[model samples]
Target: MFLDASGSAPMTNRTLEAFQAGLADGWADPTRLHTESRRARQLLDASREAFAEALGSRPEHTHLAHSPHAALERVIAGIFTARRGRDRIVASAVERDATLHAATHVAAGHVSSVPVDPRGHVDLEALARELAVPDVALAAIQHANHEIGTVQRLADVAALTVAAQVPLLVDATASIGHGPSPAHWDALVANPADWGGPAGLGIVALRPQTRWLPAWPEGDDWAPGGVLVPAVLAAAVALQERREQLDATSLRLHRMVGRVRDAAAAWPGVDVVGDPDERLPHVVTFSCLYVDGEALLTRLDREGIAVGSGSACTTSTLEPSRVLAAVGALSHGNVRLGLHPGVTDADIDRLLALMPRVISDLRAEAGAPEVA
Candidate 1:
């Protein structure tokens, strides 16, 4: 019944069990020299190694943070400032508010957002132009948009950034469990909650030999003085388990998602958004004209369905989704559905069946004529 996996996925049994085990084995201060602390350090190290192995990164390159925002904000502070003369940060317009806000806050208005096409793909030429600027410090792009599910041409943009010798920080969160990591990205941030892990855990991965510095009260960036050892192990275990089921889950989601896209498109006021073919299999978005986003959400809730409207920070705002606005899509009644492991055909069927009537009813209340 929960379709809003992007907001927070339900923790799996494997992950929950891992959490319990982690609590038992990893609940001591790892910095201490006591026997319990040594055991905790061993558990933490094992989690880091598992995370690195799954991500195709070295254990040394992985850093754990309280959240993805914490990880990316730290990255911008640590790496962006280290470059000295290069102060401008290039980011895609469709990024979730965390990166956009983080870069703007970190760079203090020096963030340049490359516009997205109406389908939500980033403007590659514009990004290349931005990267070519001598003052560009770092470039940030999402592997796939969390709202519209539009998969970016990351390899294409990564090529441009590489040639420009600008570091690329990819928020590969939306696609981490569902697809392969963009092998070319320089630094990556992922929230394990996006897969099946417990909330409040994030991963930041840096390529070896990267020029970076810890900006805050920091010792070793990778080996932070403090960490939630239980959360870390649970996150790594969840990521591994999710990746193992990705192919099967993706195939199932593709069929269900197409049904959703078709359903939304069939409604007169609802327009299916994002790239039709080159998008995430597990997510779909649509904008319903003559309806209120908040009202639609409430109606869906009444029907035993749940979905998300925008970023974690912005979904609660009355303003339209920044991502939809960037793409020139109608945002008044925007709806985004993110499928997870437990979502079923019946769940989707209920949504597809319930949506048209809801949109129709809302439009009728708004004094609009009914769809034929």
Candidate 2:
């Protein structure tokens, strides 16, 4: 009954098998020149190629990283260094802390945060104006929001950046596996875990023409100590498998998400967030009045259902969600549903059937009046 399938997913049996095989065959250091090393290198190379195919890019443009957060930090810093003459970075208000922190570090607090509308879509005119500013290095935007699942107008944003002669770095962590390949990005970061692969590995790719300098020391610039061969292989296999089932899985999950939204919206004082039509197929979020987020989360857990609360990245505390605040949505009693492909219709029905009681009971405990 686990429903919080956002940031990570359970690896499939086939992917696990590939990982086990990689452990045996790819244990050697890929940088070495010995027989075992060459075998490991072959596996690593093949994995890179397969992953590139998934991204619609070439192997030469792709590199493996320890994790998605690390990849994001590295990519932003690298591009900022290459465009040293340009000191300012433009990014959306709803970007992950990882992106914002890296941008701040490189730009020395010269980052401009663009606003998003109530639907979580970035303000294109504001973004265009910011990009048009002088000394602008690069702009970072996620292909889709990790929390509310709002898909940005990426092509429009890309056009703005291109016109301003600024490089575009896209955080594709949420959309890579669940949607179509991004057609316009100079640099990109993706999470293998988002596609039911190994969370230990990350995929970072740069367009050949992107003016990105190496952020790390020489020798192992992209990956400081190289990457985990088995993990990379497992990630590649998982992405390929997900791609094969993408069309059908996306449609099924979208319908399920719509059902969840409909059920949740029926509750009084409930505010369902995100664009109803232009959002990711597997994610939906809602905020309930007269309830504490942590209390709601704990109650759901007791009911044998698991879901995310508050910010997708900063769920450690029940602090209000930045994404919700940006969209002018209710921030309390938040529940984010990231529908895993394995979740069946019965699971959704059970969740929907119990939600009303849960909300009402929590409200009673808080002594809050019904909002009608």
Candidate 3:
């Protein structure tokens, strides 16, 4: 299930076939003048167009990068280049590490952070106040948080940034295909993995008249003429297919997540995170006091339930989730269940039935107080 849609659903046969074809086509350099190169170019263009259509933007405005991280770096560099006087950057306290790090790296002035509510929504008034500063150059906020699943008021934040004349960059990695459209930001970056596309690809969309510069010096080594052909095509096709299934899939998963949240509420010491009504439909996180998240994740893996832990970014340090910490949510034994097409009603029911017992046993083993 983890190999599939973040353990939510399985990939369609069509998507798999497309990926296979792309791989089988082999390593002909896309920039060369051979017939194979032209074919690769065509594939890349089609993919860009598909991705642009999915995001309600023009293909010319989209830049295909090796990863979402790369795309974000480009956007940040662009904002800094375009802005004249301001050297400061503002971001939400709960931003993805990649975004926060990039903002901090490029910022020549103070970097301000807008705090989140206990439920994880951005403080809009605080954001406005930060943006009001004359030296603020850019403001960034995520569409939906990765760990807690809280969706931000993007349109409201975008309007605030616009009023301040500061460019807004939105990281839509968690909510691109499954949530509301991101037509508000000056720039947006979303990963294909969130929408069932293969990894190694991300879509970056720039609003009309938005000027951006690349972080690295102009060289072919970086983007190879700023084009990632095959991966871009695959991502675009995957996004298109995912968009087609989004409405119905979202409704189905909403019901499933609702059941999980309801059952989790009955578990002692379990504190479900995020606003029940205003979060992404497919994700729900809960904290089980006194139990370690890594241990809970391992036990669930043994039970054939592939879920994510909030304790660490696996790729980086083995620390507690920064996202949860920012929102003041429970930090211990937190697990996030991200539903994909592969997860069914029965799967959710099984998890709901087993989770309470699992938490109870773990708490007992840890000698923690019983959940009221």
lDDT of 1 by residue, 244-337 (tens): 8888998899889998998778788677889988888898888887777777888888887888775222355566778888988877777888
Identify the leading candidate in terms of TM-score: 2
Query: Cα RMSD to native, each candidate?
Result: 1.9, 1.6, 2.4
Error of 1 at 358 (Å): 1.2
- Per residue, candidate 2 scores C-alpha lDDT tens digits across 1-372 of 878888898788989999999999999999999999999999999989998888878899898888898889889988888897789999999898889988988887799999999999999999988987778999998899988999998999999999998999899998888979788899999999988888877789998888777777763367778888888889889888889999999999999999989988888999999999999999999988888788888889998999988743236664567788989988888899888789999999999999888999999999999878
Relative to the true structure, candidate 2 has a C-alpha RMSD (angstroms) of 1.6
Each candidate: what lDDT?
A: 0.83, 0.88, 0.78
Q: Can you rank all candidates by lDDT, best first?
A: 2, 1, 3
The parts of candidate 3 lying over 4 Å away from their true place are 1-10, 25-27, 219-222, 225-228, 312-318
Residue range 31-141, candidate 3, lDDT tens digits: 779988777777877887887887777888877777778777777877786786788889999998888888888894478989999889999999999988799878889
TM-score of 3: 0.93
TM-score of 1: 0.95
For candidate 3, list the clashing residue pairs, or say none: 8-339, 8-340, 8-341, 8-342, 9-340, 9-341, 9-342, 10-342, 78-212, 78-213
Residue 93, candidate 2: how far off, in angstroms?
0.8
Worst 10 residues of 1 by lDDT: 310-319
Model 1, position 210, has a per-residue lDDT of 69
